[model samples]
Target: MTDQLPLERLALWVEKRPDAVWLSQPVNGQWHDFTWAQVDEQARRMASALQALGCAPGERVALLAKNCAEWFIADLAIMLAGLVSVPLYPLQSAESIDYVLRHSQCKAIFVGKLDEPDKLAPGIPAEVMRIAMPYPTMAAQYTWAELLAAHQPLHEVHRQSAEQLLSILYTSGTTGQPKGVMLSAGAFAYAGSQSVREMQITEQDQYFSYLPLSHAAERFLVEMNALYSGGRVAFVESLETFASDLRHVRPTVFFSVPRLWTRFQQGVLEKLPQAKLSRLLRIPLIGKLVARKIRKGLGLDRARILVSGAAAIPRALLEWYQSIGITICEGYGMTEHLAYGCFNRPGQVRFGTVGKPMPGNELRIADNGEILLRCPSLMLGYYLDPEKTAETITDGWLHTGDKGEVDAEGYLKITGRVKDIFKTSKGKYIAPAPIEGEIAKNLWVEQVCLMGSNLDQPLALIELSPAAREQSQEQVTADLAQTLQQLNAKLEAHERLSHFVVVREAWTVDNGCMTPTMKIRRNVLEARFADQLGELDARQPLHWQ
Candidate 1:
């Protein structure tokens, strides 16, 4: 079983269970199912079309789309045609899109459902071939149905060597330009096979695919795991139908980012007040019943493995879910390693730590406390940027760039980013992650960034939750001041916050304040509020901006 790569695994599944439903996509309020054989046939036909269109073997082809059945088929077809796959973020800016297409020199692009096709159209160079998937997307030279009808299934399965380049997944840049991480076919094969084995995933399990598949974490979780385990994968049709689509799937294995998990909790609290929920949970037998009902309502009643990644989730959020019989295991990984690193196994999850290294992975702390990881699935290198790759990878261990400490029991807790540490005017260095984590525990705060950097005292730039924004500013301010005092008591004098400035604008992907994967771009936030924060330093403890 280990000898077979992804395409071989796909062939095995098709031969073993041709009629088994592998992909379920929602369109226009209707659901469509694609069996293993259907996916196999379509991918083969497309692979033939790509070859006939003059795409040479080992060339790059780009996939720009939302997560859907066709995205999977296009990726599979790329592999079948002996071409390397490059995935661009669906919400990526036009400038970034043009940069990647030009930098990678992709021979063609497969366009699918985009939020604004017109905004992305100009990014595609005129020379690159355009193929449109079966969705409302920009004009293309060839259509999905037209190609499938024009070509026959390519009988030959392109055999890829284990060391061959599989895909170039451009990072959703939070700091600088997105760099393509070159991963081998064996990298994902190893990570996915190991993950499924350790998590006890089986063919009977179901997977939900809503997160951006362009991100390594989501691709490893939803697509790779389903491929290795022969599980069926379902997708969300649109943002408006996310909740309903999630409930309809009830995936046995589910993964979400921290932002969405916080939103889920807020949704519950809005319907049933926290005070009422606390009371209902305190009753003995009724408490169990209430917890079960809540889990069922969230469609996580059947979830055997629920994971949260892309950013650190608050311990308070995890504890809240635990009270409701939902165990949200927070793991750690990066695009550089295909997101195959440390994980909190179901029976051995630690609250503050991303659990121990997996069986064959190595972990150590640098002299400066940066976490270093060496795994079998580490990327070959950053695409066409060996200087940057050399700076990142040394002696086979990927420098994670995040500061962390490990307990004697081997649990790893990320402290902060080495580059993110800031110094005060008084020359005291402070790590903002711990302080930010503490601030995030407050229910009223949606997002917070701690900044000081040569200032007299640190200040928190916060965004209010929707519910908090509705309440009186007086009520919110009073609560924040009390929480701030409590937090200051636990901090060094220089590390204490001076003010809390509420940001009026949202930090969304559209505005470029956050990455497509939903991690806040700290540099962008700081640059946006640097002047305002300095002006408000000597003002009041709290202000509504």
Candidate 2:
């Protein structure tokens, strides 16, 4: 084992297994493989070409693209050239992209094939070198082909120290502007290696990459883990073909957000309406055969690990997947720690709790019940913001804004976000996230935003399922009303939702309702729907009936 960090790890792997497939992309209805040697050479050329453009050490290079082979090549090249890499969420609005680029002072950008580059191009700084990859774009930018053609490789030299800044990930805050979390090369390498151990990743494991790489969860868990373990990584062609791509890859280790897992649960449930179909299929003579068929059709038959995170997953949803012979392990972490904080072990899987902290990581509750974490993987600080950084990181503990409690066995049970909890006019503090997590168990309720902040009662904004909307409006409303009544009974008076509004549209990253990790933007949703929720107060709590 060498002392080389992550970038060096990639180079060493490529040198050892030059011809091994490092990445795969779907092309012409087939998966195309790119060997390790190919990736190494491509990234080297890109780095050298970037240097020719006067890119300097510690300068930022922004990558705006989906999960493609080029994304990884560009990322590695950035670090290899002793520059910082800032990955933008691919589905971000031009405005958000411009914000990140400007905030990070990115000197160059590498964008993937986009439907509309002109819209995003104008906002970028004129002095920045814009390079579009694997697709045609406007003339001011250099195509990826042109970038490589301009390569002038440098002699072998390791220019990075362990303490050098690796990347600056911008995460939205509850307050005014977003904060850029500055992380070091040591942080990524340490966390990535620890993840490989905790997740039990191996060279034989293949990963299907669909999640946005801009999110630290996917970047550390999938992208960086692939480099650490030499596993073949495959990118889905598009969201439309995600199912087909899964079947094609038969990936051993699969990662998804809680929302996607809910959809999968709902998709499976769609086949069996309300236990009537389940009863018919559960007969001793047919149960095994039917269950086997269901598993095979969903392409989950070969999946060894189907991990979900980036948001709290409901226990009810986990039980639903368990019934289908799929174990959904839910973990918890954030961008500041290179993502892996706590995860349940394979067999010791527990529902509703983010299991024991990874080795070398310590978790504790602060005086105010906020979750505090201490780890070598913790980010250095907020970029150029010493005051905010000092406030967040005190005495080696990263003050995670989340409130959690540790059980006797040391499992961390996330209660709610300290900043997100709303106080009702009744003087009762209600945490809406747990209630939202429970209501999300309803298959027809696709995505939910629970709002009550400084209000008398809470209201839920529900994005209905397609199947739910296909029913007559009266029937859809009736069923959801019944669900709300039952769910409300389980909550305290202040915690119960006063009314529900069903939205036909889905909350997605492209729409600015969700983040790159598929986490609902609470502040944005609250601002957008505050008045609409206030209108719900006219009706009584049980008025939905």
Candidate 3:
């Protein structure tokens, strides 16, 4: 905890190593690197520019952008001006964008790189001030170039105190309205400094960031980590150039959600079939060569630490990555605690458990099986919602709402969500996560959700993998039915799946069936398919929707 607070750390870097590059961004086949001195100068200028535009200290300022050098600069500028930052998701629907801006009552917003600038333009209130970044964006009254030209760097900067409120991060809602999680400077300092030491992160490390900075994981694990550890960060330009950009960065520490990890596996398997890959790995000399080539191809050759979070990854998937000499460490945490919790340590990798809690976190299981955590990095509270905040944190303990089991050696295995367990009409309770995890191991399945509320038996709604969709329907169905039968043998009578409703529609963030972080919205899917699921009969076990 002795590491300097965020602002102080930035100041230290600016003074100690002004010439060192801190951020780089790829754009249109060119790389833009920003040194510490440059970042400090721009941030200082923007801070003055904000005050000149009638923004007062302590007012909320929003940032709407994808990951870029300017994104980091704008965040630091917000802090420099003594303003609170509210980051909006780059690809969020206009409705969500509108809701957040209104809910936060933002005084001004800094616009930067985005996917659909025009589509999200209407979300900002016309009266609110708009400050555009260097990149093209929706029309704004103030531009980065104009601001830098008009104002000199502010001589005085806001020195942050540990307890001061830093930002309000709205949780990417899986079911209900998104609540703003209030995090203080101390939270970031605690988590960032702790993680830097625990992971042994140093200035020599490199970070590749693509996930939404609006989400807590990316903000904490990537952005804050870079600032605290004095590491260099590179951002992807576009979806089309993700592979090339990732290859170019060849990051030292990589963080990704389970969805992307799944896609990476699919991409590798598509090029080299599993059978052929397995055969190549059997040879002593060729195995090492083949594994190294695969790592380089995936742009993870230099990544000493590969992390997966935001959802539970299947054990079989982890095993597959292990076979390729890549150990994907799956961790567990939530936005309420700034995403600081249990994690599988590097080199001491565990298979089925998210490793023990970090040094300062306290973990305990409630009588009802819910996991409770208490830590210094826990959020101050939800913004303007005392009742909800009170309910979430009681006696200094945060109710995680997730059920888990910890082994004697302190490893924790998430069993299921306390709210996700449902009882069938036959009075048997089912936890869908373990069942869904087992179902997801099948090659034909891409995503699976088990829903059965007051029904005779739980039914599975499955999204087919690309390879499965290319196969004949009959063959796919026959293979899936056999797989279902084998899976049911291991479950209790009531827990056995009654139907396999193969769905063609993919559940994605844009479709409202997934959170921005890519965790499936179970409640949304359950309600969406309620009628279709009810129409099932005992006549057949499988059907296509």
Candidate 4:
């Protein structure tokens, strides 16, 4: 791996292959490409603009927007000016944005291509300089293009050290208050280099930039990795048209949360009804043709590696995709570790395990079964939270709050979160993640949350597949009963799912049912359905459709 930092690598790329297309964007149904030279020039101009506007080096500059060309430009500008970049999730609640901005102490922010700027404007502090991308329609405090055109270019490199603060990424806050993870150029350089090697990212690889860049995984996978490897990064036009955009790009490598993968499965099944599905399965030639068509239509045909992380993927979905010629390698990591810790090797992949730790990272299970990791990928420390930082990293090993064990072949199998394990009133400990993974293996069960805290046996909150809901209510009920009965037989007395509640409404990030990474927020789910779950227990062992 190169010892050069991420910014250094970008500078080198800009100098060497200035004309290579580094970023691709689709605006107004038209695809646009930007070369490294174009990106560097624009970034420098933006940096000059910020400097002219009384922005100082080492100050925090936040970028509040979705995935777009401007996000990259703003980030590079921040780096160029030797400022720390804090990316805020555009889809998050106003309260979340406010918390991150205040915590990071951002003096200036760029809100780019927002669908609801009016809602966000109320949350911004009057003291903070609010800048809008391109031109403003919502009348933000400042505009981007005008500032860039008036300011003199600053071409001199800021020359940041390895320990200099590069970014301050706020956590998704699935639990409580979000902690800003402070990362340095050295830390990200080491982490991104290792990730690039593990992911086998090459210049030929094309990545779809759809996930929230505010998240570590996507930022590293799409942005940092793209710069290091000279790979092309494509931004989806919008969330509503992500599927269409994916088809247009046909990215060689796609990164998605498990939730999107579930939707992809539903889309394929919906197009081919059960009758047609059965008939196609019967004819070998036709089955292959139909499956290929389905994969291509979902923009997964050319995908050399379809990765899902930030949450556990259902083992069933893994197997199903494998059956259709697409190999999904699930990874396991946290924000504190710079996103990737262990990823299943390209060919030597496993369905149920998160694979062995990547090179330069150590993984061991503590006596109590907590997954422990020590790596260069580790963050410098949490911003302004020394107590928490010290507690998280002990003896150089980050005590990942997850419980898991390494298999004989060195594969790491995550059991569940240490705090997420619940005890039944009967005093039996129940791990919901593994049980949910077992149930979600069924194609019909798109999403499941196991609920058993202070109960006799566990019950599941299940979201149905699109194809499953198309069936008659009687058919759906009968199918659920049979599937549950079979699933129960596979589990021990304490682990068996006793009842299932069908959730008609889909869980989404916008709906607050899921995180930006598509992981179900268990604490939120439990709180929201506390009364409903109590009603399910009153009629214990009952299934609701």
Sliding window of 10 residues with minimal summed lDDT for model 4: 536-545
| Whole-model Cα lDDT of every candidate shown, in order | 0.92, 0.81, 0.90, 0.83
TM-score of 1: 0.98
Steric collisions counted per model: 0, 0, 0, 0
Model 1 regions lying over 4 Å from their true place? 1-3, 537-539
State which candidate, 1 or 4, has the greater TM-score: 1
* Candidate 4 lDDT tens digits, 288-313: 88778888899889999878888888
Q: Which ranges in model 2 have alpha carbons more than 4 Å from their true place? A: 1-4, 136-140, 173-175, 271-277, 537-545
Against the true structure, candidate 3 has what lDDT? 0.90
Model 4 whole-model lDDT (C-alpha atoms): 0.83
Better of 1 and 2 by TM-score: 1
In Å, residue 51's CA in model 3 sits off its true spot by: 1.0
Of 1 and 2, the candidate ahead on lDDT is: 1
What's every prediction's RMSD, in angstroms? 1.1, 2.4, 1.2, 2.1
Error of 2 at 135 (Å): 2.7
Please give the ranking of all candidate structures by lDDT, highest first, separated by commas: 1, 3, 4, 2
